[model samples]
Target chain A: MQELKDEVKKLLEQGSIAGFLGMIATTSGVVPHLFVADKADEIEKLTTGDVRYSLVQILRWIAVRHPDDKFGIMCRACDERAMTEMFRNSQLSMDKVVMLGIPCTDELRIACECEEPTPKSLLFGQSTAKKWDKADVERIDAMETEERLDWWTEQLGKCIKCYGCRNSCPMCFCRVCTLNDDPLVKRGEIPSEFPSFHLTRAFHMAGRCVDCGLCEEACPMDIPIRTIYRKVRLVVGELTNFWTGESKGKSPLAELGDGTFPIQ
Target chain B: MADESGSPFEPKIVAFCCNWCTYAGADLAGGMRLKYEPNFVTVRVMCSARVSPHFIIRAFQEGADGVFIGGCHIGDCHYVKGNYITAKRVAIMKRLLEFLGIPKERLHLVWIAASEGDKYAREVDAFTEKVRAMGPSPLKQVRFWKDATVSKKIYKSEAAAETPAGA
Candidate 1:
């Protein structure tokens, strides 16, 4: 804790970042909050949550509005991945931001089965987890074609279309979404024109999702949103041999010019 | 096979054809006297890569019984590797569809050259049959027919309630 505090102090004292994007315990839940040295005292109450926060989204909001000022983020693997993917897509800039890595606890790790629970830099907390379980994705993979169809139909039927998943996602930074459009998503459906609304989000997140699991958490109907994203990630890994956030400023699979880039 | 209500299965297939190859292939099928199901509504795009997965899903959402992407075969793609990306996407999307409890067969990606008029005929025939057996898409049946009024009412009321932070 002291080490993390010291790093925060050093970062703030450097005057490089305009503010710090992290989280604090609110009465309702742990929510993302922006901390600046002018308000550095608030860093004392900064806390981590078993639940995830959209801290990157908050940083993105400030960064896009004020591109000249750099900011620091206390991000986990998912947050870093989200930021990295966004950066590749030109949504965020690494030049104007400093990353303060925060590793997830063993308890949080088990909850999400995160593979890279630790961040690349500015890491906080003890490393307690390794490896990720692919069973969640494989279970779907193992199902009979017909059975899988039935499963998704039933699951999609429960959708309330609250947009909670999209809203909570740190990487879903689109100014306009086709899912919300009346023509594409057929506005007014709760379960949301199955496959259309969810698949659109999933397809868009193909090279973009950071595997943050916030979408699943924020889903009111408890849809297995991560399953689709994970499958996309796996597909991307196979097709492009690239992982979002593993590198900085790398080109995305969709951007590969005519597949002659030798991605695989 | 008439039950209480006589409802003949007239499946709705949504075909996404690349403007360069398959769309023209479909046009060729029209030029020739190829007889196949007219169930398909063609959505033309410049390239197979331009067909986002959302478009296919949207077709399903909008009452499509089956969705098909007809593109040029791998090496023959006019845009070099456009079909390769389409192939990769189709592979993953088929898996996703199956996971969602929609039969994987409902979504198909076929490489039909502009000259393969007969292949287009066969694909449409097969797809139409497959969709016929699958019956109406569950999404089409539920979102369009059942609880639609209630769902629309809830969607509107909730959308209006969202206020951007600090607004």
Candidate 2:
């Protein structure tokens, strides 16, 4: 925490960034908000808590409209990974930005089942655990085909099409989302089409989902939304020899050229 | 083959064709009067790259029994690398569909150049037979639709009740 404060102090003193993006204590809970910490004194106001929101969405809005200004972001495990994936997908810029990496604590790390809880640069805290639960994926995979289909259909049928899941995801930054497109997703309906609207979004996130779990958290119906994307992530890794945010220079499998690596 | 209801199992398929190659090839097949199944509804886009995996999935949920995507040959994309992306995308989507227990034969990816009119006919004829054998998709199944409608009503009321007055 002390180190992060010092880093923020330096960035503010140097005037390297137009604004600092992080969480501010809200009346309800902690939520992401942009802070222009131009002076050293404002650094005291910044706080990092358990509450999370879609910070990447904010970064995306500012990055597109104001390309000239630089921005500094305080990113944790999933947040940094998400931002990295967003950068690869052309949603965020790496050049006009500074990343203040904070490692996840053991408690938070296990709750998220994060694979990489540390970033390249450490702004605060020491690295903890990297817990991954394959049980959820395995359980779904173990179901009979008919049972699986029925289960998915039943779960998807509970949707009210609030789109809270999509809105909360940092990687879901498409200005013209296909889910809203009439022919593709069938707009103006309750309980959007099963295995189509959600599965399509999941498939699109195959090599791009950073496993942030924001989509599941945002779903009002409490659908196991992360499981779908998590399976896609695994499937892409198995098929294409790539995982999102594992490396910087690698392109998304969906964007790969006509190169086939033998499915091992 | 006719069933008890006398319906011929005419499954609806959506074909995403790249404008430069596959779409022109389809037009060529039309000009040549080559007979193919009319079950397919063609959606022409600038490149097959524009056909996101979501579009194919949506087609199925919106009542398509199958999806066929045709693009320029690997090295011949008009956008230089667009069809390459399409190739990779289709390959991944095929695996995903199979993983979900959707029959692998229901979805097809082919490379058709502007001159492959006869090839286009053969592909469609083969795919039509394949889908015909698979029968109608779950969307057309009466039991599935009945359950879907009932579940949607339950969900609608639950959603309304959950979002209390400005809370």
Candidate 3:
């Protein structure tokens, strides 16, 4: 932890970056903080908190105001993957960004079922990559058709229509969300009409979801929102042979490709 | 659930046709006097890709037992890649549908050219029958109907005569 703090401090002092973005321990818990040269002492509290925050989301916000400024971003493997896609999506400039990857503890990796827990620029810990069990997706897949329908109906019916899932999603960056659009989901409905609300979100996540788990964690209704997204991700992964949020390339869904998208 | 008279279930179908091809194809089906099931309502859009995933979901929510999308044959889209995008969207939409418990078959996507009036008639009839066998969409049971106020009321005077205003 001191090494990380010192490294960030060194980056700040040397003016390699105008500021560093990482988690800061707060009275309640850990939250995102911007470590700058002017506030050099603040680097002491720089830590990868016990909980996950979308560091890239914050980075995007900061970059919008300070577009030309180079910034050091502390990232987990998931954060790094998310960041990579953001760059690919033109949400951030790669040259303006420096990543200090924090390899997740094996315990955290296993708990998240994270396939790759080591970012390209590893600051610490051993590289660990393994497949997620996908038990949740498979369990739902195994259900009888009627049973599956009932299961999803009950699960999605619990939605309070809080944009919590979208708000927490690293991939959901659209300033004007389709969820709020009329004729898609009516304005001011509590249980945002069954299936469309959730399914629309899953469809949008098709080729883009990074399996970050933040949306699932943010759901107050405990909807298995990530499970649906994982289905789309796996579908896209199998079809395009491109899993998003990993190594780079524009998502095929993001454009009308050379007309040879494999459609079965 | 059946009607009050308990008639056989007739599945309501919503078909989205691309303006350049399938919509024209449907017109040809009529010109040729090709008889197909009258179970479908065709909504024409500028292109097949214009049918957003939510449109299909909204179709189901509005009580369509089946949602069919017909676009120009792959390479023949008037916009060049609109149908191609439609294909990709349908692929994604189908997966999400299956995961949400709707049988993937309930949502059908096909590439039919403007010259393929016979194909249009045949495919729609086939899909209509397929949906009939599947019975009502499980989603139809949700019965989420949207009501809009009518600007003109036909029975205002009659309603007042039938009952006291307070009553």
The sequence of per-residue lDDT tens digits that candidate 3 reaches over residues A1-264 is 677887899999999899999989878888899999999988888877667888899999999999989999998888888887898789999999989988675556555766566777887666565667889899999998888877776667667888899999888788899988986787677555777888888888887788888898899988888899888889898777788887467788888888776555
Give model 2's docking category.
acceptable
**Candidate 1 pairs with clashing backbones:** A148-B101, A149-B101, A149-B102, A150-B101, A152-B100, A152-B101
Of the pair 1 and 2, which is ahead by TM-score?
Answer: 1
Q: For candidate 3, give the DockQ.
A: 0.31
DockQ of each candidate relative to the true complex: 0.27, 0.28, 0.31
TM of each candidate vs. truth:
0.81, 0.80, 0.91
lDDT of 2 by residue, A1-264 (tens): 778778877776688888888876657777776777645565676677766677878888988898899998888878888888887877777888899987765556555766676777677677675656678888878886556666676677777889888888988877788778886777767566666777778777877788888888888988888888888888887766688877657665645555443211
lDDT of model 1 at residue A13?
78
Model 3, position A63: C-alpha lDDT score: 98
Clash pairs, candidate 3, are: none
Best by DockQ: 3
lDDT of 2 at A114: 65
List candidate 2 stretches off by more than 4 Å.
Answer: A26-28, A33-42, A63-67, A105-107, A127-130, A250-264, B1-12, B16-55, B76-82, B99-101, B113-122, B142-167
Model 3, residue A241: what's the lDDT?
Answer: 79
Give the higher-DockQ candidate: 1 or 3: 3
| Lowest-sum lDDT 10-residue window in model 2 chain A | A255-264
> Candidate 1 falls in which docking quality class?
acceptable
Query: How many clashes would you count in candidate 3?
Result: 0
Give residue B161's error in model 1 in angstroms. Answer: 34
